[model samples]
Target: MPIVARANLSPASREEHLARLESATLEYPLDVLVIGGGATGAGAAFDAASRGLDVGLVEAGDLASGTSSRSSKLIHGGLRYLQMLDFTLVAEALRERDLLLTRTAPHLVRPVSFVFPFARKVIDRVFIGSGVALYDTLQSLGRRRAVPLHRHLLHDKLMTVFPALDGSKLAGAVEYHDAQVDDARLVMMLARSAALHDAAIATYTRVIDYVREDGRVIGVKARDEETGHEFVIHAREIILATGVWTQEQQEIAEAETGLRVLASKGIHITVPKDRIPAKAATGIITQTEKSVLFLIPSDEYWIIGTTDTPWTEDVAHPAATAADIEYVLDHANEILASDLTREDVIGVYAGLRPLLQPVSKGEKAASASTKVSREHTVMTIEPGLTAVAGGKLTTYRVMAEDVVDHAIRDSFPDRPSLTASLPIVGAQGYRELTAQRSEIARIREYDLVRVDRLLGRYGALLPEVMALIDTDPSLGEPLEGDERYLRAEVVYAVRAEGARHVADVLMRRTRSDYEVADRGAGAAAEVAALMAPELGWDAEREALEAETYRAHIAARLAGEQARDDASAAAALADAPEVPRRA
Candidate 1:
């Protein structure tokens, strides 16, 4: 593999990106300006820049702060879509899944087996077996092998594999492979890779309006949410990958983008891994009164969720109500021998899915979000503006490719996407590093497990993290509260990963926010102090950062106790906002 040129996504780099954003002009228009710094936007920046185009991307919040961070964290070919007879969507997602597992982000994405327990006997055995068989077949069509083929397990065998499972109700089980990822980290890596390729990227830079000339979008008027600095970013082409905020962006443009996105709220709750008692990532497809429920296995925790219902409230902060928690618990308790109560849940999160509104007349929208198609659509909102909506996390790269391809069709007719073969920042040489993990651990004076953990998170970039440890031996020590993460990781988040706020480091950069029972409150002060120097924060500012994060956590807890969305949103509003510069 060839070594790709990479850039550090540090505070210094963010300053440079902001400088470029402030200086953009119509006379010197960027080849592509991407809106939304989530997965798709970051991917588009990388895709366009890798193809030798000058690209710039802006995000209102931290990368993956929206729907991207709140995903189920599974990079699977939507297995449920197959039941809807959407084979094309499943195939495309599977191809992308395999690409991430094998070529693109092998370190971040790895194969995880899912045990789909079946309660119904004859009908389910035939229907689900065939569906999974087709799922495997589609994966085989891909160039690389990501995971093993699906296999049917008898009830007796299933019980042996999953002792915690109450096999009394289960007739059998079908075990299949899918992939899991740290979704937020993937977005950050994409942005970092784009920066390496010379694409200007800035976060907390909100697009206030479009820069229009003759009814065509040539750029955007943006405001830095942190600094309160507003400016114009000139670009020859603009792509919107704003997900649930798609319609909002169109409204700002004041042009009919010919796209309508309905926001559907999905909420997930996290518990300790021991609470679920699953050896592998286990899931049972049981019908809820409203939708299906999935109990996914993440590292050190079991994430069970998601209530799919219409969300008409604020998209920025979708709160999980008491009812949402009850819904998940009620459905999850159906198959488990031990019932899960509210006390068992350590963390709760809610995100909105942007479902493309069907256009045909007389097409009644289904009340259940499961019925909505996961397919994406790209449209020309104007001469220079293009927008994409309604895609899943697994297909973000493909969505990015499509949006960029469309946006640059007329301008750069000959240049094609190069991200298909491009490995993300940490992916290159990851495998070799993993093979030498023990040796590296010995040299670094750390245990093999610690080295393995770092490799999983940073891949071949582990050395970069280790360099921080070398400079400050205290960084090698475990974080005060979370032993799973090192103090070094927190510093690296600020120094090399463009983490500006305390929440950005604890919540997205590390899973400490949800992985631990305290939701990162225990480590908040320490993490904030570590980032203070890098971000040029005074002692007062550092204290405020810690206080803000604590308030945010408290608000999230209060929201979880609320009975409905309205009350939940109200409770979440209690959190203090980050102070902006005047």
Candidate 2:
């Protein structure tokens, strides 16, 4: 039988989690308290909870609202790290990648082939080809290969593979495989799995300061960002997984020394897939002056981006400037049959990478932000407080295990982490359920295309969505003004996925915000109406939620008009926030 995991998160669960924190004290404290709700933090909660530890996690915003959601959404062995000669990182990441594709999240992650167009004939093939060969070799070392091996394509074959290429500037191409994932969904699933293991999970709860003992960290003073209610959470050990905010969090704990983390900004723009014709290709990547440019596929649209530069502005609201958008378009147009203009862009987003500096060498080792390693670092900020930062989405599991291991090394010395072998909430029966997709759609009276899409998102738990439809047949209809998503999805985001605001349901729970031209503004009122009754919001509150969603989108659109990071961030500052639910 598949592992039984049917957990749900709602406002009631949030209240329960908060009560657990409020009731715990010195005599009865949680074994581990995790701060941050991004990928690594959620993973740490899963790791600790699975090991039979009393775990409690708190987040300042919705899950994956930070760097976790803003990723390129690719899960690979860090193909770029091979050039840096980080063989161990590549090999370890490859193992994890295979695990996700096969064992853990077969539904959310799938292999994507990328063709690297050759600029020079011999030198490019010999150098880049050998590097790709090594990338495959490392994957072969794992128990099983998640994706296929690399292949070299001649002129005719390369053109057949990717017809969009200009063909005039390229000699040939080499194709290799990597995986893409639903970044925010993965984090949410991880949190749900942890909750199933008896972990107390809370979001929109910010840790204000450390509750310390005689020169040792013991607990935290926190506030409910949604209600402004202050409380204390007592824990034996506190794990800080606050990516770019690591230093800021350390200051709150009043630690003597901590890991020095620098913020590197990366941005992505979405465009209609038909704009760039690729008859036989999933995507393509090419070398850029600063970083490698990727044209990855995501559903109906293509996600193309990634400008890696130093970010000295706000970490909370990273926005893509006009210059950043122009840089991506120019690079993408370099090899495309037709040049892309600003009108081709459907949406844009910017996220910060926690570029961790080497703890051994201190903070001044690297001058360029691009030169910094994407690897993670875990340090004992003090006696009982530990902080971890850096590392990409591909290696979040490893980072989680490492952080949890640090938390329990002295306390639960005999316990071991069960995450590597344990499947997440929706992974166990996912394949079987997928085989029954047509039957599922037939019984539920859903479109075949709609069922297929939801399966990719929910896996074995697709039935849970069906159950929602059974209770309220109206939810089975397409989301108002956004036919791409079902109304049930919005309701699920609240009743099961812990979405509190309209933005939470529209943006993170579903991709309606970025996948659409208006960024889901047209659907804001409808989405708010679906969530209002579930969240106990009055008519005025529902209107406020809808307006806040629209205002935030306006702020992002205004930010996109800026040419620099400072101005873009300033524009984003005008974005209205979700009001406290007191």
Candidate 3:
């Protein structure tokens, strides 16, 4: 990795980015301007910038604050898609998965094993075994093998490995490999990487209207959510990667022709790893009546999710209703030796997937969200505007390339995507840092576990965060209630990552939103106070941000108590909104 200039997206740098966007002219406008700040949008920004083109990206909220942050956090090919006979999506996703696991983001993404248990001896094994074989074959064809091939295990052997599994109905099981990442952190890093490549990255900037001349889309009219000030962001081309809100953005742009996306709600519940024996079981998958059930494993929790149902309520405030929780628990309990109850759930979240609703060549126009194709489509919404929808987290880079390549191929110079070969900021020197984790801990005189956790979160950039500990040793102390997150991590989030609000730090920058028992309510004020100096906030502002975060937390909890989506959404009617900074 040769020396490439890097920039931190702090308050000052964010202002500079906004200034550049505000000052952009039609003649000297940005080569490409990307709308949306989810994975695909961030990926498009990085893709455009890495191609040596001038680009600017604007987001309606914090980075990865949408569907990007609310994923199953897996970077694998959808194994279920293989059963749908959608091998093209499976193969494309598998290649991207291996690319992330092996080359692009080895630090953020690592290989994890999954157990796909069979319900019958003959029929189940034969069909699923063939699918698993094809899955491995797809990976091998595109890139170097990044994970081990699937291997079969007998019923007795699997029971030894997964005692929590009800062995009475189990015929056998197959263990396979996949990869996972901190989904929100990946988007933040992507934006930062784009900035490193000279892309102007702006968050909390909502596009209010389009800037068009004659027939082609030229720029956009956007508002600064923090200040309630509106401005123009002129560009040669505009691309929309807004995930579940794709249709809304399209309607707002008045494109008349674009993607028709159906919002599908998926919810996940987090439980203590000990309660579920997630470490012993690794990750488990089984077929459910509605969709495939997955027990995703993380460091300290088991993330069990998700129901595939249509969402017609507010797109911004998707909640895990009581019935939704019950559905997940009942389906999961069907295979568990010891059943998990609502009492075991420490945190719950809901996310909407933008499943493309178009009728493809061989596929019928699916009636259910689950039946829809996960394959992404890129098309010109207008002469100078391009919009993309449908895709998984694993294939965001590919989607970025297709959209950007389409937007720029006719207008701008020809330069292919370099993200496949380029590493994100923290990935370059990661392995060496991991190897010296203990030595780094000894040098800093911090606990080894803390050093390990920091390394896992920040990778090669651990030193930058640890440097804060040197100036104020107090920052090294644990957060008020959540010892898992250090005070320095919250401060680093405000200073380096674009954490404009308290929720941004708690929910996205750190996993405290879903990882902690109280959803970071206890540490909200402390985190806000730590962020005050970096963001030039007064005491009143700090308290306001903290209170707003608390109110939002209360709304989420209250919503979880409701039995239906209508009632759950009503609980958020009073969910506090972040006020104008001025």
TM-score of each: 0.96, 0.97, 0.96
lDDT of 2 by residue, 1-582 (tens): 122433577788889889998887989999999999999999999999999999999999899989999889899998888999999999988988888998988888888999988979899999989999999999997366768889998878888878888999899989999999989999999999998888888999999988878999899999998778999989999999999999899888878899888888999999998998887547898879899899998788899988998888878878889999999999999999889999989988889999986545343555578888877888898988888998889899999999989977999988898888898888989999989989988887877888878998999888888888889999989977678888998888898788998988878888777789999999999999999999998999999999988988898988899888998898777775465465
On TM-score, the leading prediction is 2
Query: Which parts of model 2 are misplaced by more than 4 Å?
Result: 1-6, 358-367, 580-582
Give lDDT tens digits, candidate 3, residues 395-423: 99999999999999887656888888888
Tell me the deviation in Å of residue 211 in model 1.
Answer: 1.3
Better of 1 and 2 by TM-score: 2
Deviation of model 1 at 485, angstroms = 1.0
Residue 470 in model 1: lDDT? 89
lDDT (Cα) of model 2: 0.88
Q: What's model 1's lDDT at 195?
A: 87
lDDT of 2 at 326: 96
